[model samples]
Target: MSKTEAAARLAVRKTYKLYIGGAFPRSESGRSYPVTSSKGEFLANASKASRKDARDAVSAARKAFGGWSGATAYNRGQILYRIAEMLEGRRAQFVAELAEAGTKKAGDVVDAAIDRLVWYAGWSDKITSVAGAANPVAGPYFNISSPEPTGVVAVIAPDEPLLGLVSVIAPVIVTGNTCVVVASERAPLPSITLAEVLATSDLPGGVVNVLTGSVKEIAPWLAAHMDVNAVDLTGVADEDLAITCEQAAAENLKRVLRPAAADWYADPGLKRMTAFLETKTVWHPTGV
Candidate 1:
């Protein structure tokens, strides 16, 4: 066989799909959209998620919340660190994806993303201690407050794609919240590939579901979902769209993280992690 023919035969194209309940499935609507590189070269068809897909993702997240939140914080930390290890092993693939999507600093972005995951992983067991407080009561009572997961969180991934995605998702899940993430519409291939990494990691199924499609089409559904306890709008750049989604989220008084320009490489602080957390205080009698 000719060299050119052999090379062509050796090339394998990948079809990107939505990750729901830890399984890669095509959009329930059977719709997909073309993904292209910065040079306008054809890449692949990415799943164009629909409202039903968003609903399904929420269901999956809700189902996984109990076990994930109830698991030992140390165990959750191990799983998150495992995800970082997996990402490091596949760094080459992520760099390629980011470069194809027009990111100039692909390698740096990949490295920063891996590092961000590690940072959040270390926070898993420490967040409670750092955020929790014990109060001195006027009476003979012990009062202590700690942070707890807010159940299902819906995340809208940012335009920066790789680094932005890692920044938002790591904080939410590290705190034991399950999430349904909407990957950046224009550059979702990397996020889908990240899903592949999560599937192989020690992380539990349905803990992190990813959808690749129009945020306009799916974000509203997730925002309004009764079972979704929080909404992260860090990725929605359109002002009108962001407001609409926030309004929908108010239907259930869901914890809403409004949209804002973020420097993904900078310190994320504890805001993102605390946004999806609820504080629970307990009181015990000292005279027991």
Candidate 2:
């Protein structure tokens, strides 16, 4: 803007809030941290989620789990697809955020993220066909096993703000598990923006709660949280911190996915979705 244009109007800054239970709210601790761009330029202030915030997120996830998991797999797939459509509409915004966050091939990353969502959406209903099985028994019994969502999961997103976040989140939710996801600390703007998209989508509130803050401070609390059913340590780089979260998770026997070096651009298979799934087998008398 020119001098007169700049003088006439001031930019309205956006308040980057946490997405908990489908609403945007300030952190419970009332702390906000300056999120800087790739070159140390101020982007905006993101909520510095505290332990209390983490607990709230977990509660929200648990509350939504029953409804989300009970919904038909096809319904979940439709919601995920809707999210992808919304993200496509907001491509320019996501591209800008990724560029500011110093991601190379920003547009490509955004496209991959969108495609990843679509991929997982397609898998939602089909996963049962592939994972569920019928076993032949010598007796007159029909034995069948099927997969089910493991309940609320806590995810530490990888540092690739957009693609990595989508890569982890889509798999978890598409499989019917509600989740409390900690955005990548290095760059959370894109993740929060994605939360906005989610808010408008058909996805129910609390099905996917987003928290942006220090992973070290928030993750341990979630790991030890008795209500959380699983903890994904994909973004924890510190070995010691990962260990601490693992130990805490073990206390409740929460399903744990250890930190792994992942290529966000590569094809992510069924493993991520399977990690938090539990199998149930039933035996029925034939022709009873």
Candidate 3:
């Protein structure tokens, strides 16, 4: 075969799809936008999620919350570790995406993201111990407090793209909270590819639904969504936009992780996990 024939045979384009309910589907709106590399090279067309798409994602997340939250901590830990393992296997793909998105150290970023997942996987069972406590009261009553998942969460993926995306997502699901994430507007290819990773992993359907589009257009719907339990605005770099979303979240009393500057490569600690948790205290009569 001639070189031209071989090159034509090898050309296979990838169609980026929206991930919802463990299925990859074209956007309900049937809209897509061009994705370009940092040097302005055309990569692919990413699904442009709409308001209805956001609603669908929320519905999927809410539907999955019960089973995910009910699963044993050990089971959740195992699943998270599995995701880390899968990511390890896809290191080359993620590195390529990160490099295309203009990251300087793509390989190091991918390594950090995998380590971040493993770190959070280890914390799956430990968070309860660290965040829960047995309290002493004046009366002869036993009081104990524990943390629980906050149901469906909406996440705005950070602009740092690959590593930032992983940093925000791992902590939420590790504790059994399902999420609908809006990928970085400019660099969404990696996030959708990560969705492909999640779909193949041990994670159940709707545990993590990802949307690719303009955050300005999609974020308000998620923030104000009545069914959504919380909103993580880690990706909203604009203070005004973040404030607007926060106000909308107030309508439903949603747990809001306000926008702030973050170093994605730094140790995230327990803050992200704790943000979407609800503390419940129980008291019982002793010696009735």
Candidate 4:
């Protein structure tokens, strides 16, 4: 076998693990599902994360939120750029996974996926300056408002696999917010592999966690999760499911982004950044 083929064979046998609190742990439920390669061949077992696993992922995100959000914009930008670099290095793996997933335009999807990461990486620092501004409230006091991270974010990744997953996740983390992502139901193996990329990309543990399982089973828990500050329904295709998730988010006044049927591979501009931000107001008395 060629060196590339040898590496591919070895990766196929690697047992995938869930990243929690910056460490790999077998699912608390001890469950796994079969992962397949591009050729309809079984590759490995992906962790079948349970409710307990979802909750654990949330806890990890919550714990890591402070440090991640508190990081300087420059540092966050660097980390995001690092992820793009890692993704570039592993382009072949993603291409292989996409082929296995049977995408009709695997080449286009791969290009879009890598391109999406780079787009978001550059936005890591610039978003704050663009979306966030010093608001001037008419008063004899110093008033300033700027955008801040919305705590922990829960996202339902797009079912298109490569473009879909990157579109949702890149925006969530670029602004210093951590996320618990549920991968596409039909094609989850790519999401699992992406998680591996993050694990090695210098991202803090829990800053971006991935879970592969039934969204019908886990998404509700996230919507109602008090610790989760926001919800992105970008992946919910069913109208009823979207409605139910919206209702759950309203429970805690969680920020919600309704799903849109956008062509994800097309240019996704500032919309993603504006969707997940919170405005924070700072006030002080001027006539002290």
Candidate 5:
């Protein structure tokens, strides 16, 4: 076998761990399930994160929020571009995972994933200018409308493995929001690999965490977590599950992005940034 093929085979055996609070740890539940290729071939066993794990992820994200969200827009933009650089180096890995996940045209999935990252990287600097505004009122006081990141975000990444995952995650971090993401049920390997890539990128520890397991098993707990400022249920296709998430979110009035019925691959408009932004109106008076 070629050296590259042998290396890939060897790397596939390495047990994956959850990225929480900037450290790698086996699931607190100490459970793992067999991961299989889209062709039903055996891959590796992935850690199955439990409820306790979900709670811990929330804690980590909450702790990371202040510094991450408080960072200057220019710094945040640099960090996002750093992630894009890391992703470019790992294109082959993503391609392999998409192939195993049975995505048609694995190249297309990789290209789209890279393209999404590059697009988001560009948004990091300008989202503030694009989404935030200065307001004019009839009074003498100057009024400004600015956007701020919700404290902590929990995302159910797209089930498609690549595009779906990037769509939910890129926007969250671009605007300085930290996230705890639950990877796809049938396709967790790529998510875990992506976590490794992020770890190498300049992302602050706890800024982005990944869990691999049943979304049904983990998502409800996340939706109900009081510390989570918002929940994105974009990957949820089951109406019952979506409703359940919505009901749980009502506990705290957590900002939620419901499932999209249209094609996300289509050009995303302003909504992507607006959905996660909280408008803050500041007022100051000028006296003659």
Candidate 6:
């Protein structure tokens, strides 16, 4: 082919769709919105997820919860590490997307996100030992307390996009909880690509469902969903919005992690992992 022929060939653009139940699907509402680069250039059209899509994601998460929570911690760690490996392989793509989204230090951000995944992956098996312990009782009985996953989680991903999304998500699932994540509205492209990484990383379907579009439109339905066990409001910068979610969560006594300022680059420790964990104490008599 000549240079002119090559130049005349039309570019095939990628369609950014929502990742749900291990499959990429168009928004149920059949809506899409333009995602623009930092320079106000048209990048691509991303699925505009609606309430029905959020509900579908929740259903997917709930369905996958039992099997994921039952998987061996060691296995979970391996899967998370696999995600990091796939992400590292696609480093250039993520960097370019973040740059287009106006993320400064995009390369460092992507690196930090990868390192964070590895960090949480290493913690998968070790966390139980740290978060659980034996208790002293006044009887000849063995009493112990252990951490368990808090069922399905609904997450509002932070505006920081990639790093923050990875930060919140890695910990939640590493501990064996499944989640439906609301990708950053301002920069949904990276989240879509990350979903591709998740789908190919040996992670089970429905373990994570990524929703892209307006948070205001989709978050309330998640907050009020009876089947949702927990809600992370880390991405809600609006105080009133956070309060509304908290109030709605109260209806079912859903575990709510209220909005708070976080430095995505700083040490996250075990809080994010622990936030969605529930303690179950069991007692057994020693003597027969």
Q: Which of the numbered candidates is closest to the native, going by highest lDDT?
A: 6
| Sort order, lDDT high to low | 6, 2, 1, 3, 5, 4
Q: Give lDDT tens digits, candidate 5, residues 1-288.
A: 676554434443778788898888899889999989978998888889999999999999988999999888778877877877887799888888889888888878778777887788788778778777888888889888888898789999878888778778888988989999999889898888888888998899999999998899889999999999899998787889989999999999999998566465776666766778899999999698
The parts of candidate 5 lying over 4 Å away from their true place are: 1-12, 262-264
When 2 and 5 are scored with TM-score, the better candidate is: 2
Q: Where is model 2 more than 4 Å wrong at Cα?
A: 1-8
Q: Candidate 5: give its CA RMSD in angstroms.
A: 3.4
- For candidate 6, write residues 179-270 as lDDT tens digits: 99999998899999999999999999999999999998888889999999999999988888888898999999999987468999889978
lDDT of 3 by residue, 52-156 (tens): 899999999999999999999999999989988999999998988899999899999999999998999999899999999999989989999999999999999
List all candidate RMSDs to the true structure. 1.6, 1.7, 1.7, 3.9, 3.4, 1.7
CA shift of 196, model 3, Å: 1.0
- Report the Cα lDDT for residue 74, model 1: 96
The reply for model 1, stretches above 4 Å from the true place, is: 1-7
Candidate 1, 229: how far from true, in Å?
0.6
Q: Is candidate 3 or candidate 4 better by TM-score?
A: 3
Error of 2 at 277 (Å): 0.7
Residue 224 in candidate 1, Cα distance off native in Å? 0.9
How much lDDT does each candidate structure score?
Answer: 0.93, 0.93, 0.92, 0.83, 0.86, 0.94
Q: Write the per-residue lDDT of candidate 2 for residues 158-262, one digit (tens) a residue.
A: 999989999999989998999999999989888899999999999999999999999999899999999999999999999999999999999999999984699
Assess every candidate by TM-score: 0.97, 0.97, 0.96, 0.90, 0.94, 0.97
Instruction: Give stretches of model 3 more than 4 Å off.
Output: 1-8
Compared with the true structure, model 3 gives a TM-score of: 0.96
